[model samples]
Target: MDLCFIVILLTFDVKSAPNPVNIAYTSVALSLHTDLVYMESPPGLQLLHCLRFDDCVEGGESTYLDLFHVVEEFRKSHPRYFQILSTIPATFHKCHYDRENPYHLVYQKPHIILNHRKQVVGLNWAPPFEGPLLVEEDDVLMYYEAYEELAKAIKNSDKILTYGMKVGDLMIFNNHRVLHGRNEFKLNDGIRHLQGCYIGIDDFKCKVQVLSNQVGDGQPPKHVGNQSWL
Candidate 1:
C-alpha cells in the first residue's frame, strides 16, 4: 500500500565510532525531541524495527513523554512562560551541503500552536533542530526564560515512559504527541541495528477514526495524534 511503501527503510546502527554523520549513530544521550520539526508537515507516526540489540549494551533505553501532558502542566504552572512560547515564532532547520543526503530546510512556527480561546492545538518542538531564534531583541530574554522553564519541566517530569528494546522489537508512536529520546549506551563488543520509517499523519488519523466507527463504540478517539486538548 502507498502508506506502507518503504524507500529502503532508512537504517542506523549504534556503535562506537571516531566520527559519526548523525549524532544518533553514536554512544551519546539525546534530549527529548521529535523528528523533522523542520518539515512543513512532519511525519505523524514513526516505526522503528530493531534488527539487533545486544545484551552487552549497557544503556540505550528509549524514553518517551506525552507532550500534551507536559504542555498542559506547563500551561497551568507557568502561564506567562506558556504565553511567550505560544506567541513568539521560532525557526527550525535541517541544512547540509557536503553530505551524501544533502538537505536544506527551514520552517518557522510558534513553539506552541493555539486556537481560538488560546487552547493548545499542536506543538512544534525539536531542540536539536532549532535554528537561530531570530526574535525581537526584547523577546529574546523572555523566550529564553520560557524555554528554560519548559525544558526544566520536561527534564523533571515523572510521567516519562522508558523502555529498553530487544531484537525483533518494533516501536510505533505518534510523532506529534510524543517526545522521545535515548539514554547513553555503552556497546561492549556489541552493536545495535535499527531501521525506521514514517507514515503520513493524515492517513494514520483517518484509519484511527474509521476504526473507531467500525470497531469501537461509535465514538471518535479522544486524541488521534493531533495535539487537540478536547
Candidate 2:
C-alpha cells in the first residue's frame, strides 16, 4: 500500500494517555529519533510548519543531528561496535489502536544501513519503538553495550543543532539522514502549535529531475546519478 501524507497539529494534550501510543501528545522531553523507523520504508522527507508560538515559553527548542557524520566518527572511535551495528538487524515494532482500523507494524533492520559498496548511508534509531532483543542470550550484553555507546555519542555530540522555531517558520529535512527531537516545555506557560507532513523520497526526486530538465540546457549534471538512493 502507498504511504499517506499526514498533517498533524503538535501540542500538549492533557487528556491523552502518556503511553508510547501517544508520547508526542505529552509535554515531556523527547530523545532524538527518526519517525516511523518500524516501517519497512519509512518516510523520506518531513516538513514541519509552525502555525503558532508563544514568545514567553521557556523551553521546547528543536534539536537535530546528522547520522552520517555520527557514523563516520563512530567508525573511528568504536570500530567494533560500528561493525556490529551495521551488520546485525534489530527489531522495531508498533501497534495502532482504532477499532475500525487497527494495525500492527514490525520491521527488522540494522541500526546503520549500508549501500551496495558497504558504505553507511542511512539508519533506524528510534529507541522508543525498539522491541525486545532478538539476538542470542550470549550476545545480548554485547549488543546492549554497543547500543548504549551509540546512544551516548548521539546525545553528547557537539554536531547537534538546536533552535527555537517561531510562528510561520517552516523546516524541511530528510528523515533518513537526520534525527530530530524536542526539549520539554511547561504547558501552562503558553501555547504552541505545529503542522507537519511526510513525502516519499522517490516522488520528490522525480519532481526535482523534471524541474532540472526543464531549466537545464538538455545536459545532465555531472554529479547526477553519482549517489545511490537507499
Candidate 3:
C-alpha cells in the first residue's frame, strides 16, 4: 500500500520514471526549504553535507579517503544491511556545456584545457560544474533514513541502474532500490573523499512528485529559451 503511494508520488505514472529526480528550479526553492527543515531534523544531521567545490580535501578527497570511519559514524544513525567497497575508479567525465561529448583523457574545464594545451600541467582549478548528482557505485553502506527515502523514490527505475551521489558527502542507503556511486570528482581542497552506509528506505514516504507533476516540474524556468530541456 505504502509502496504504491510512493510510486505515485515519485513517478506519477506507474510505467514511467521521474523526468527530473533532482528537482531543479521549482524544487530548487523547495530544496532551500527542505535543507533548512532537514537540517533541523537531528537524525538527518549526517544525511548530507551540501558544500561548494572548494571546501573539501585535495585530490578530490581521495587522498583522505576513509570509508571505515564514515561507516562507523553512519552506524550510529543506521545499523543493518550494508556493503562497503574499498576502492572505486574515477573517471574524467566533465559536467559543463562540453559534458555531452566527454574527452576521456583531455580535462574538461576551459581554463584547465587551455593551460594544458599550452603545456601548463598540475594546475587544478575546481571542475566546471557545481558538483555531481545522485547515482551509485559498488560496496557502500546506505544510511537507514536516506536508504528508506531513496528506496521509496526509485522503486520503479531501471535504465538509471544505480545512483552516483553528487560531489559533497556520501549517500547512505538500503542497497535494494537505493543504489550508490563513487562519482567522478576533482579536488577543491585537501582530497575528495566520499563514503556511504545504509539500512533501508522504508519509513520515509516519497513526497517527491508524480508524473503529472514531473512533466510540469521538469519544465525549465520560464526565462530559458523555447528549448528548456536543460
lDDT (Cα, tens digit) per residue for candidate 2, span 1-230: 43233333333222213354467766688899998888888887788888777887667788998887888899899999998898777899987775356769988788987678767767888999999878778777778889999999999999999989988888888787888999987756577777777777666665566667798565432211113542
Across 68-95, the per-residue lDDT of candidate 3 in tens digits comes to 2233343344333222111111122323
Q: Candidate 2 — what's its lDDT?
A: 0.76
- The stretch of ten residues in a row with the least summed lDDT in candidate 1 is 4-13
Candidate 1: tens digits of C-alpha lDDT, residues 1-230: 66533333444454456666678778899888988889887887889888888888899988999988999899999999999999898889999777788989998788888878677778877898999888789998999899989999999999999999888999998898788888998888888777788877676666767788888876655544465544
What's the true lDDT of residue 177 in model 3?
Answer: 19
In order of TM-score, best first, we have 1, 2, 3
State the local distance difference test value for candidate 3.
0.25
Please give the clash total of every predicted structure, in order.
0, 0, 44
TM-score preference between candidates 1 and 2, better one: 1
Error of 3 at 227 (Å): 42
RMSD of each: 2.8, 4.9, 23.3
Candidate 2 clashing pairs?
A: none
lDDT value, residue 203 of candidate 3: 27
Q: Which should have the higher lDDT, number 1 or number 3?
A: 1
Worst 10 residues of 3 by lDDT: 31-40
| Model 3: CA > 4 A from native | 1-52, 55-174, 186-189, 193-199, 205-230
